[model samples]
Target: MEFSPRTAIVTGSDSGIGRATAVALAEAGMDVGITWHSDRAGAEHTAEQVRAAGRKAAIRQLDTTVIPGCAAVIDELAEELGGLDVFVNNAGAGDGVGFLELDHTIWARTMDINLNGAFACIQAAARRMVAAGNGGRIIAVTSVHETQPKVHAAAYVSAKHGLGGLIKTIALELAPHGITANSVAPGAISTPMSGQDGDDPEPTLYPGIPLGRSGRATEIAAVIAFLALPASSYVTGASWAADGGMLQMGPVGSAHLDSSNWRQG
Candidate 1:
């Protein structure tokens, strides 16, 4: 089916990758619904950019950790936007607690925010798309850890892995509905989450990454924008890694590890 997306909802659009994606979709001629977890001002800023691109923009405060109730925001936004053609689950959280130090609270919070919340929101969006009888796109912004394990991030890795698997299953179940589900697993990015404060990633040396630097949020946004387009109709259930070859560095990284400090993390 051909996709002519006119409206999109991106959770966590207050800043970083989500903000970039909202703007990209707007630039592609779609009205955007932007949500923020804690930064209403930031979300408004993103909305301003969308409006500047000559598209309608809607703003809402969304806390994914709120579960089934939080999913209502999707419906509200879809209604406000006239309809929903694209849904991007970019709201997630992570911590540096190792497996041994990981507690139930932290674990559950991480799961609630990253995996459980994603399930609810994506399901809500899919239901709307199915009811509208319009094919749609569902994209999740997972991490490279979705496919690889990382030190000091057991919960994060687990959540991302679960979210990735959920997308694959959704792809199978929703294929007949003309909805495509996919995940974008990004590597180290220069966002506030990475302590970079949205700086240019070019000069920042990401020693182990093959690209020699961290990825820019806009770079990941481009990949997501492509997946949202009709050009990606043939693509689904795929996890596109926008990482600068970070996943490919496993063997190569091991070969270059000159000290035991790598395990200390």
Candidate 2:
């Protein structure tokens, strides 16, 4: 677990789970590279937190949907931080369009960010690690939807399922190079993406979350940090769900009721 002076990159780190992960990595004694798609201020704030933790912080602008160029940001940050030791593919977009209403444009956008972007970035990082002759960690921030499906999020579900498969493949390919690949699948986390401005969850969101509340971004980050550790070398090709027992509920929960209400709003 001695990550002292190691370098890590976290995408979509301007806020939410990404921000928490960047800071957590810093606190664990690793220099962190933080990227934001649109929120420069939030990225800066995350940098400040990293600096305060006595670790170096590098910030960059990355739009995962930008194709091959988007993945180059990892190289840039690695150069700035001296080298790459960990890469967290946390940048993703969610879709809520029903299956019948989904369009090619929406599906493409979702796949471009959540799947294509991650593939490119992982390739870039793994190349560096392999060339450097040092093992590295590759963690993707998938969701419970990676396994369980939602009523109206066809695109997102498909992209995450693909991501899960990609991570497993990477785990097999990279293990020979001494690198490890895994995923952290979160449930309802109280981030801006989940419609909460703060760490606390709304009462209405409690019904589906088995812990009776939404999770905090830091909760998910802690798991990511564990997977990043050198001691986790044997844990590749696994999806660690940080969900509040929601995934375990499965068909037994109230969510299984024969109701089309989930598709209405």
Candidate 3:
């Protein structure tokens, strides 16, 4: 519980929520290791922001589907940063194909990126934390789909759900080492993954969300940053939903539905 983290690593920090989280952790006085999949420039941008916040920033290329190689990237970054006190598993992707049309290749890729890769990478980080004998924090960036089902996103939903469960199991297994594991589930956010710029989510009017708008990447970052801090030491094995009340729409949506057309999605 007495945590003074000096270094942190965030996967998929090249953009969106990952980028925001790296910056937030840096602002919290922790050196940050940032990883990118395809966008080296975006990763560099995040590093710059980290440096601007007066924290050391290390950049690495991470392809989560690359199995042991991706796990190696996490270790490499931790080494470069001197040590790892916080690890955020934020690298993930979703295939929007319907279940009827989903293929094994796509399903496997989704599982590898969002679940399998996370398992490997988080395990690697946890090993370092255990060996260092420093109480650490492990946070996963899951989605609201981790709890709710999406119409055309069976693979994605399942993978997020798996990641969420993995965090809970980790919380139980790592507690003896003083390592707390948790997850943050976000609703529709304005990010590249959501086909919108990762800027202002306030102007985007979304009637489905109770807040009447999409969420900003920074909003979710704030929650993740809190989990990585000593203030959250007592919290573990928990999933925090940063959605704009989107998860609470099931009953409301059903009550207001004009017809059965909603079943098509």
- Please give, for residues 113-211, the per-residue lDDT of candidate 3 as tens digits: 999999999999999999999899999999999999988899999999999999999899999999999999999888888887643344468887899
Expressed as tens digits, the lDDT of each residue in 1-265 for candidate 1 is 6778999999999888999899999999999999999989889989999999999999888887789677789999999999999999999989889899999999999999999999999999999999988899999999999989888899999999999999999999999989999999999888877776542344368889998988898999999999999999999999999989989989899999899897667
Worst 10 residues of 1 by lDDT: 195-204
lDDT winner:
3
lDDT of 2 by residue, 93-146 (tens): 898888999999999999998999889988999999889877889999999999
Choose 2 or 3, whichever is better by lDDT. Answer: 3
User: What is each predicted model's overall lDDT from 0 to 1?
Assistant: 0.91, 0.88, 0.93
* Model 3 spans with C-alpha error above 4 angstroms: 198-203, 259-265
Please give the lDDT score for candidate 3: 0.93
Ranking by lDDT: 3, 1, 2
Error of 3 at 24 (Å): 0.3
Clashes of each: 0, 0, 0
| TM-score of decoy 1 | 0.97
Q: How close is candidate 3 to the true structure, as a TM-score?
A: 0.97
